[model samples]
Target: MKTEDLITRLAAEAPATAPISGGRVVMAGLLAGLPALALLLGLLGVRPDFMAAMAVPVTTLKMVLPAAIALLAGGAALRLMRPEGRVGLAGPALAGLALVALALVVWRLVALSAPQIPVALMGRTAPQCLFLLLGLATGPFLAVFWGLRAGASTRPALTGGLAGLAAGGAAATLYALHCPEDDPLFFVFWYGGAILLSGLAGMVAGARGLRW
Candidate 1:
């Protein structure tokens, strides 16, 4: 074939955009895995009583690290996944979902009715508020990253929800490993709270990021 014709054929077959880079996939996996790894490290050779009390805070910090990772990873995912442009309605829709999810988490927390209300609200210490704020900051970005991946795969809601559930479950499992308290109250209050927050953030991201 003539050179001109060969060039035309190649152009016609070229993808409209590049595929997700390998580095991004690796980064995402690492970010998602770090918390679990931290939990394992915390558990090794640790006493149960000390582990139980410290586990809550440690797990909370573990969760926070992933959110930071997600923020960077999500931005990269968004850039790669939507080379064409951002799907409309993703930002506003996600914001709305976030509002609803936050409300639900708050309601669940309130129902726990700890003997000392502030302690429950604030977790074991006042510093928990700072951790929660960190979650809030990075959670949305993580959601957006996962949401983009879901959108690329054409299963936005399902992917987003799964991401949320995974995050929740991971945190819960870590807490469970360390927690001495086996009562339903512990799960309902502490474990449940983490899951709910993560899930809500995931839903918001899915709602927003999935839009085309």
Candidate 2:
């Protein structure tokens, strides 16, 4: 085919432009996940002493940290939708959060006796917390994935990982409402593990699902 003819055909077959931006996709993911998350919350029920629990500074951190991560990581994920997008502040911000979490975990570890260390790490619901957070994050993660399909991300794995981080963070925020375990040892370890796993899952999904 002639060069001009080939160009014309390619342009005609090109995909439609995305309807929204990456940041919006992150928000939409949350919105899409809300109903299902709410239903799950209803089944689990919020902690009875929520009001009292919130009074504790550590308990408040449990909610705030995850929510902050969702917002920040979601922003980065959305930007990655564009071919020209870079990591920008997302890397540093995430590292900062990690350091903060690690410090908190260390502090908690110091406060606990040797016997308590094992018990603290293995909080009352060790298994439950990990699975519940991962399950809860799935809806939002999938939603974000669907939204990102409208985009043309060059770095699918990174984009998906960020989206997963956002989804997991949001789920953790909600889970904190029901989880009475306020200790950093438990929340940081279990919640972080769940979010990391979510990121890994996202990486795999992006590798397979985002291909044109």
Candidate 3:
């Protein structure tokens, strides 16, 4: 057959929609394992003292992990879901801005105050304000992944959100285990904060990235 005819035949045979595979399972497993790993790390005494004046850098590193994980996983998942689609850079950028704005609005509306900024933030000794800022900065990259996952699947937004929540929660739980600060306030503020921020970021990304 001629090359053009062969190409046309191949195109005709391809399914209009890609086959559903085990992508969700992989996402679920990653979501579930993060917390478990953190617990394991904690048991192994991998605590970093963020309270120490000189430990600022170390604490910052710890704070950035969740965002980094989200970005990495989300990016990979997006590519897998739609190999032909381009990355949703704009989605993440918008989501990141929205995340920060929403956080500030909540802070202002509630007039909430922390007991001690560091202890209340991540339960570690690092500067809570600085860590939160860093988390906000990393929101866009992670949001891209969330957006991709939501867009790729036929699943509902709620389902996608739950998956994202699971991923974020699991990661936060693990981070808490390794952290020496056992304050509920810290988890509520920092860990919980991370999940909520990431979720919103995901929503924005999904809305943009999941276009046909």
Q: How much lDDT does each candidate structure score?
A: 0.47, 0.86, 0.47
Considering summed lDDT, which 10 consecutive residues are worst modelled in model 3? 132-141
Q: In model 2, which regions exceed 4 Å deviation?
A: 11-19
Model 1 scores a C-alpha lDDT of: 0.47
TM-score of each: 0.43, 0.91, 0.42
Across 14-104, the per-residue lDDT of candidate 2 in tens digits comes to: 9986466766776778687888678767898899999998998877888888988888888888887777778798899899998999999
Worst lDDT run of 10 residues, candidate 1, spans 125-134
Model 3 lDDT per residue over 125-209, tens place: 4354334333333433343344445445533342334335435644553454345654334434556566666556555555555
- Model 1 residue pairs with clashes: 90-208
Per-residue accuracy of model 1 over 7-83 as CA lDDT, tens digit each: 99999998887555535543564475565446444644233565455446533433343343334323333443544
Ranking by TM-score: 2, 1, 3
Is candidate 1 or 2 superior in lDDT? Answer: 2
Which predicted model would earn the best lDDT?
Answer: 2
Model 2, residue 27: what's the lDDT? 74
In model 3, the Cα lDDT at residue 47 comes to 53
